[model samples]
Target: MSAILPPSQRLWWKEPVERIEIVWIAIAFVWCLILTFMMPYWHVFGKQNLSNEAYRTTPQAFAAKAQAVVDKWKVREVNGVPVVKPPAGADIYLVGRLWQWWPAYELKKGESYRLHLSSMDWQHGFSLQPVNINTQVLPGYEMVITVTPNKAGEYTIVCNEYCGIGHHSMLGKIYVVD
Candidate 1:
């Protein structure tokens, strides 16, 4: 490679970097250090963390629990689907199976609810559209999602994960009432 360059230009690589280049290099190093310290600092001090609360239960056991929630809340059949309007600050249960999300709920606006979501057959997605809250529903694991609807409207719940040929038909609803 030295044979391709003239003798006068061969000493360029031996020279030190300029002062501005050194300053930029130092700046980049400090920036990297700052970024490296951010994650642990956030974990210790920030109010942001992933929810790791989950429990193991069979599909049958979960179904019984869901039925208890439904029976206790006075579930009504709306066009062959169950719809429950539980009292304020009540815990709600939702069942997800192949191509279906059962027992739509009616929630009071500005009231908090603990939604216990589980799957009966396969992995599914709990996606509330228009509001855009999404979470995964896995079989044998109950995932709890806490939400308080601030706006009064009907939010469509659709499965965002592909489960089967009728995956597109997996839909539900949550009515946020005034």
Candidate 2:
């Protein structure tokens, strides 16, 4: 019975790995270390720094804060939509709900603003057209999207995610002015 078993199987645990096996094992171990090192480096010096930072608040609380901003800086109305031009280098709030984005911003051509985005009722999408800035809008969580308007035009904000029957009507606007 002992002779019937192959030499490879008989002393499997005692057998030394081949040269190729050792090389492959070393490569895998090195690769794991590289990946482990990359994560922290990327987090510290990556464009995705905004993804890690978030503000937690209730929908009602965030809405009130957003409303205050709207009331404060609302300049005029363009076709029933209040055009809000936030001060350059200031924080702006945008509330998303079923079928609308509140207080469309009228930004300067070459100014940056930190946009605080949150959903009022359900999960929504924040898609800035033409410039093509897209982000996820979650309920009870405030996401800050830093944007610098390079062009002077009216950009449409469309909801890329399906929330409800009125999803198609979930249209918003951001007008970058000179």
Best by TM-score: 1
Clashes of each: 0, 0
Q: Over the full model, what C-alpha lDDT does candidate 2 score relative to the true structure?
A: 0.86
Report the C-alpha lDDT of model 1 over 38-155, residue by residue, as the tens digit: 9889878975443567889889988998888878775577667788898887878899998888788888998888888899999999999898888999999997766778899988
For candidate 2, the C-alpha RMSD (Å) to the true structure equals 4.7
User: Per-residue CA lDDT of candidate 2, range 53-145, in tens?
Assistant: 589988899889888888989998866878887899888889899978987889998888888999988899888898778899999899877
TM-score of each: 0.76, 0.73
Query: Ten-residue segment with the worst summed lDDT in candidate 1?
Result: 46-55
TM-score of 1: 0.76
lDDT (Cα, 0-100) at 100 in candidate 2: 89
